[model samples]
Target chain A: MSDLSDERIREEAKKALREKGLKCVIGWSAEGTPTFASTEEEIDRLSFNRSCVNNLVPYLTYEIRSQRGKTRDGKDKVVVPVGVVVRGCDSKALLLLLNEKILARNEVFIIGVPCSGVVDPRAGGALFRKCVKCAMRNPVVFDVLASETVQEDEKDYSEVEAIERMSQEERWALWEEILGDCIRCHACKRSCPVCYCDECLLDPTDVAIKPDTTAEEKAHRPLWVERSVNVPENLVYHLARLPHLVGRCVDCGECERVCPRRLPLRLLTTKLEKDVKEIFDYEAAKEEGQKPLIAMSCMEDENGFIM
Target chain B: MSKSILRKDKVAEALSALGKQSVVYAPVKNKRGIVEYRELGKSASAAEIELDGKPDTPPKAIIFPQTEVLLTYRKDKDGKFEVTPARPDEREKVIFGVRPCDAIGIAVMDKVFCGGKFTDPYYKARREKVTIFSIACDGPMDSYCFCPSTGGSPAATEGSDVMMYDVGDSYYVEGVTEKGKKALEALKGQLGKPSPEQEGRKEAIVEKAKSGEGFTRKISAESIAKLDNSFDSKYWDDVARRCLSCGACTYYCPTCHCFDINDEKGGERVRTWDSCQFGIFTMHTSGHNPRAVRAQKLRNRYYHKFKYSKDNIGRYLCVGCGRCIALCPASLDITKAISEVK
Candidate 1:
């Protein structure tokens, strides 16, 4: 992880900026928060550590739209890639977004940082649960490699297995307490790389009515979840995110890290990931172009999924 | 004001005694090892209350809950809509181990809810029944505290019922108001007369709090004044470029009392805590949003904390408890945002 010094990352980023005509380089600041660096001085501020927990691949879409960079020169038809510093987990997220056709291959100039794992925000020393089971310590896809690949750990589902072993009542009680703590801030939804939506169904406001929206459309808008922050309503909020994350979730674990209540949010997504892989024999972003499990259903597929 | 001493060994008995009469909310370390103001119950005991450092979260929820119903609406047999005002929690509540910055945050919220043009019936009702027992900080709790810069001190007693200062093995408690004095009556069995040595220690703690030293994170007067002309500066976009547009800052802020009223599933009109950082917070029903960009939302939050609150309520809304800095996923330091405004 230390093979790529902070200064070396800066040097590469500065080179990428000029050669790639990049508008912004999304990276971690000295304090380990995501920051946008455009100038050489701002690029110099870019550093990586075990505290660099945020998966900045999300900003690849946010910092740059389909045109790659938000701020472009006058009448330049060429789309310049936005330079991004991505860890192994983040590179997986980037490839999934690529498979979805949300972003093109050339839309991002990926500066891959080979890493071990980020430390848990709760404990200063303990690695995050996702990091402990990380299968890839090297970027799945990258334009330029920042360092030599680090040793990776075997997948461990013990944390998820422990919860699965809980009795029906115990599991229900655990979720009730966890979801009860939710403030409905949507921090988990906002931080995820793949949760980008023009109009999120989980939004408390059911309808983003346009000027030309039909009366029938307005009348038929379903209030799937209410605005109340109670356990029942919060359960709906989290449940809505579960299905939408079928094959798309890359398990970056940013959701649990950013939670102010410190909810075990990664458990939900990671459990879903395990189930999908065990049942469907598919892993998200395992290749450049892999169809999502939800998209690749056959007639012989189990009808019990509807339940 | 009455003065007394209660040895820390007797603290749990006193709090448990008060718990019989009132639901005592204290800074109890949660499962994650973060201290938050939580109700003393079977899960969290009075003996487990952590009072040595600043709590990870402010104690705003004890008075101003994140989600509360304003009114309930239903239809009768004749189909006529019947609306009833939501009943407010009337239980006697004593918030123990409150830091002074959080106490001052409640004072600011008091101005926002009841002191202004309209008195919020809910806030007034709940605020009336609760009593604050603030622990005076001998100095800054951590590197993040900047209460003195925001019109509060480590020993500020504006919103407390009883002010408590650590005096070695015992606490030097002073009653700040009549309500505080009355609440102290519940602990009379454990109370003892304060000696001259105890009084000297209390004064020393008060003097140190008044001087306001070791607070590395603070905004200057010039910085606050400079914000007057920094409203539309490009600096906000630079700071907010990486903002995730989440409510981590606003929800954790003690003084941030902005809420949205909505009719819920049960035909109840509820007031829920809303964040200025959210993209749709300022969105119009007609598909227009004034603060559409993430940068604009960040700008509006800072402005509300510094400018709008001051213009309307006569003081800055921020308490400088640094909960925003601590809980913020982006590390958006409000002091830095205001002081670095150009």
Candidate 2:
């Protein structure tokens, strides 16, 4: 696909605020960070480039809703629709949000861009690891395309294949080395658009651990996951998050990019992504109104083991 | 006030000599070109030590490990529970190649862990066993450094036992304390007097480090003071809108000391690093969180660094290392945020 000029994208964002009445156009700044352009000046500051790497769909949740305007009357709050510029990866997240009923279809206006690839800021403009094997260069769902749709290369699972070739012990050792360095920052889960749980199960306070409380008194508190930075706890914390991501993960690569330790978190998610595609014969966010693989009937699934 | 010069070539000999008495840690780049502070191997020399800039992770882990077992309890044969302290392997240690900002960060942490009424015995034990060798930065390590603004210089030697200034092919070392003086005396044979040219170069480097060139940004005391009254400012909401609430900024920070203690199946009680950026950091047992909002939590971090720590310890918690600025996923630059504080 041909790239849309930055100026053109800026003008379109400004128009969305003024003409289409968007509360804000979630776009990019010149420094390649997320910018919420609510006014003309902010829209003027909006920029788009190969370095715009953030997936802005995570901002639409109630967690960020405090930034919205409030009314004096004690009435149900009416949310203003926001315009968001999306690359193929972000549009996939948006589709998952729409499919999960977490977000209303008409609530967000997606300004889709046909992305060739985004550059890793840390790697000096090299294509990000997640982008190298991308099968969706065009937005999965968009209200308008900023440019013509781009042709996507056939998906390559070579990286996933190499991991599969590893023996079970070797796979365990690889993950042990990777997760050993995790600081438990939760950057991976926080950056994930599909990980919208208000209280994550991995959080220590969320998992209840009552050890035979008396009839009137409770002593033991909840401890879901141990608060150590060692291998066993970190490994369990990462693997437990996979069940929640069954068919919803978009392989956006934001998790790995945000990691301070630069751990290979995407490799784990990519493994799951490949498994879902092969077993369920489903791809995440491919089309609107489709049920997620976890939500669909098992009878239709190609995995006979489930039957 | 003892001073001497050590040639770059003889650094390996000095390290080898020091290794006989103490475990030596130096910054070394991994296969991925990411620098980390690790213990020197038996065959490794000072050539492997990277003194050019700060490591990706600070040397705070040397004194306060990412995970530490406080104590372990075991059921004896008599059916009584016996508790034993899980003491770290005691060893005299040297951490070389720590930047001045990071060394200052250790001093700031000192104020928290050692200055209070209740000192952490675990941290105190480890800290008392380690000596610091702070290397001077000739100029700005990168585009994000701001040591001068935080009452630190690239040549500041606040917490280091010895300050080593990079002067071309040699290092001009000066002992700042009794410990440093003792270490210098021990390595007297490996050291030599600085030549006139080397002394001149050292002075020039110190001057350049003091110049504003090393600091591309500023976080003035006035701006920091303004933060005291700006808790409810809409600026926080704007700044934190894109924040993923990832703990990268706090985790990579040299002075962040928040921690959580938990018990494991092996009857081990462990304390590990925790971050205020996490949602459950302040979650109440009754499900009442005073700072449940993400913006509120982010705001508290700035206040703690610039306001609360100053109130408690008479020093800002942040040492202007710029790790938070460089690693924040949303590009939430603390220096930029400081400028925006009204």
Candidate 3:
């Protein structure tokens, strides 16, 4: 579908929120709305703007746990269910939550739309570069699919193919070149939906290697070796992020879009996803009840190299 | 000693009959030597078992799935929350043709999940309901198998309830548990008892496995105890630099059991697998990360298996199932790393 048609779907979602007896419809709207108007208004639906790029599931979780009720006069006042609008990839996030037993499936109303994909506003251009090549133009697991027709065309992974064409040394060189600009800001991690760790290992205090040491001293320390944005550090950092996405990353391209340097983060994830499918014959969040590809093992699993 | 001599042709009929009585999962070959579990249809042949070598994936998938719904919740209009248990169907399952190393891995997992303070009821329910029918490995399937060094034998009976050995013209089955006795009793009258020669053949197979190059790498378990003191050792940095940290090693490992809990509100909650190898695996809400670098993250993966799990579970988390050696893109081998640890 075109940009004009997507706006129409957004309007329909707004109309659904305007219906009677609905507590609040959660949909994307313009950014910069006043917090009071966004939360306290008695309007039919709540819309987020382009900054709403983060999956609504995490925010919904926060709301469900913290704002679900109020105590008045020693009695509890009930909070209404929040209606959420999700795209195909967003729906997969919701499904993963359900599968993990973190959230009940029936608590929130999902308005699923056939997503043509959304532009990452953090890319700071006409649109996020990755959005132009996105394949999931239509959502698969939505309660209310916005599009009538599904786009089943094969995604052109030429961008990844272009990188794959390079030799291993060349690929490593490219990664080093890109990661050299990393400030370790971790905006990419914070914006990710699947990155729901209670404690991140990057925090020096959490793992407690040494918090008082200088960067130069820490860099030479055995535990802190390869911790910088140098080639070795960048390679390790990039490699460390791949398994987190196994059977979970929906190829949303959110990380790349949010990166300050616009490093091709999605390519690394997508390449791993491709290998996972090829090696294990599995897809991440493709089927509702399908097992996480990485969790299961067999005794007969081929171990030809270790012997 | 008990022995049965069924013609190779009758093996299919025997397995088919067994399937009629219980849930039977066996390895079926697909492309690229990949192995997957398929229901044993009435006419399914034993030829589908692929006993010539190890399957690409382990049997842990059958018992401990990658992702399983633990419970479901519904919020009534009255705003009261109701939780519904999501349990797997109670069915007696027989995992036929499991390898010795894989079976031991399951046994290790059983100790970890079942004996812990927080019992995984889902895993327990499946464990209590399933019976393992282990097939002894006659020869090394690949170079990555270091079963000998890690206390694994090709034909070890450490985990299997019933151990099976393939003789030239017949199959010999021995009962190692009461469950195996009952299964054997059920199969009585259709087979001859074990002869002295069959028992001799079993010993020969076990001996062959013992002498193979499977134990090429000898790691002193005591050396792993020094890992705590070596926390800041340069060894981790060297390994971490080579590690892609892609989690293939942990994910494919038979004993790595870290997971993450998430709430997907349609009204239900879910929990999925998490890996310690990721930068965000231990990320805290306060915006601090404990394993910010690949070196630390990589160190956690080994230290947890060798030190913490041994302290808690009474054994190293690794069961000598050498998946990490075979599937690593960068050729990072755990056995080689462990050999170099000291």
Candidate 4:
């Protein structure tokens, strides 16, 4: 377990809320929910544990991703600064977000917690798949250390390897069954840090998950999803997401963890991670300002789709 | 009026026997270890019936599917169009091992889709043929159940045709309605006469549940009462800050029956599950939306569940089955949201 105490989390959050002049400090609640604290009393509810399952990085991008040039806090004239708590894997997402300029360095303060991989309470308290293969127990970046850093585990790709070894037909059947049960709730997409687009390119039928458009756009935008929620659409949605997160996904497994159907989402992301390592000789950057993976192009690229 | 005892071992026999006639749906654990309602078939039987606890998803989709085609239309070479309305199902169905909380949820959905100003023909057709066989939870099944708070007991019988109790090695069954009694006649050969001892055990369990004992999680009446004045409270923005607006909570909820109708390119009109949490659910054709912000969208769900549903239907929309609590990607507990509304 991390030596960082819940008391320390509350102390740091209180500092951010009071001293930083931020309206709220985003952190894990007592029940390990993604929550915010605007007051000292609310800060007291801040907690850190192996059960703090959600990656809080996505919450940061919601206001900034859509409705550009505006803060949701209408009453405040100045841009509001918020404090955020991020774990090791979560810090990686923050790094990618910063690299893409989706979030700016001056807009917020960060309180990083070095984590000893979160455990899945639903899976009988077993360590999460991402934690089992965790290469960094220490936060990649942070303003404060809430916990003592721990030893990291060697990366394991056995789950991905098992699927890779399966025959083409066998692989198809496995994914078919897993994807067949999808209900198109878009929980995975909405929770993902990288899937920040207001309009999904798959179907731009003017239906935005976030109300990002103006009244004119809402009225004039063509309404529709070209595909329905059948096996084909389910496959397209999930499979398209795998490649989109090739380098960006930090293997948080939030998608798999949150799937109501309990689909094996790890298989897709892990396999792509292995392939990205082999083909591009790359992993997502650990520092801000590094050019993101999809941004750079090279002659040695394994796939020729990008001429 | 018929009561019978089904041995633990004979459950498969009775269910398999029923499967030979009408469609049978019971709880089955998938390879992923998640329990869900699956149809009994050649490979499915009593050994596979998972009655330990409720499934993460309600069986609402069994009656109201996630996606359903209402009608199809096409153009002919003569420039004329033809539309064919989808047929309502006529198959008989038996749903077994439903938790009482979920049964109450179905009853609430009945109020929404089949009892309001207009009846949904699709929902009414399937609902009429389904015989609910609800199993009783002697105490709180887990940390999330609060059926009593929503005016439902651990063994609610409002929506269920039959109620079953686990008494040692056999099930003590009671038919609460005429439909439930008639359905039991099919299992006459498999059922045995209930003994006085079994009857007593079932009675004791039912009686203990009525007293509302041993539930760690409950929504106090005071908390629910506080919700009426909390519409403009700042507490909503605070709690909603963490919401991802995934719509998973509404999708998994048993009683959230909001649906959207869309016409396909081929002129087929389909109806699918919709949620107020989604930005498009309330979007007007004129590019206007009333519940546009994240906080507004999230707050609408709580109001619909607690205040509007109560004012309209005389009961809270929530049945306290806690599927939303258990399945939410973010830990937005509905019980906490309503009770602690600022």
Best by DockQ: 1
Better structure of 1 and 3 per lDDT: 1
Instruction: Please give, for residues B25-46, the per-residue lDDT of candidate 4 as tens digits.
Output: 9988887887888878843666
Candidate 3 chain B has its poorest 10 consecutive residues by lDDT at B30-39
Candidates by lDDT, descending order: 1, 2, 4, 3
Q: Report the number of clashing residue pairs per model.
A: 0, 0, 66, 3
Regions of candidate 1 where Cα sits further than 4 Å from its true position: A66-79, A205-221, A303-307, B41-43
Deviation from native of the Cα of residue B79 in model 3, angstroms: 2.3
Better of 1 and 2 by TM-score: 1
Worst lDDT 10-window in candidate 2 chain A: A206-215
Docking class of 1: medium
Model 3 ranges with Cα > 4 A deviation? A1-307, B5-7, B42-47, B210-214, B221-228
Residue-level lDDT tens digits of model 3 in A1-307:
3444345445554554454233555555444121111232423223433334545555455444444455867665554555666666677776776565555555566666665545443334344555565566455555565556456446557778899999999987777777764534354664565666544544221233344545665345333222222455455555676766776777766566445445678887778767667666766767566576556656765456468
Q: What is the C-alpha RMSD of each candidate to the true structure, in Å?
A: 2.6, 3.5, 23.4, 2.9
True interface contacts reproduced, per candidate:
0.54, 0.60, 0.00, 0.60
Candidate 2: regions farther than 4 A off:
A1-4, A18-20, A62-77, A205-222, A297-307, B42-47, B75-80
Q: Is candidate 1 or 4 superior in DockQ?
A: 1
lDDT of 4 by residue, A1-307 (tens): 3334677777877877777787677788766888777789888888888788998878877643443464477553455677788887778788788888877776667888877778787778898767876876777867787877878887788888888899999999988988988887778878877777777755322266333556676556553343367787688778876777878877767788878778878778777777877888788855667777787767667766655
What is the TM-score of candidate 4? 0.93
**What lDDT score is found at residue B68 in candidate 4?**
90
Model 1: residue A272 alpha-carbon error in angstroms = 1.0
How displaced is residue B204 in candidate 2, in Å? 0.9
lDDT of 2: 0.81
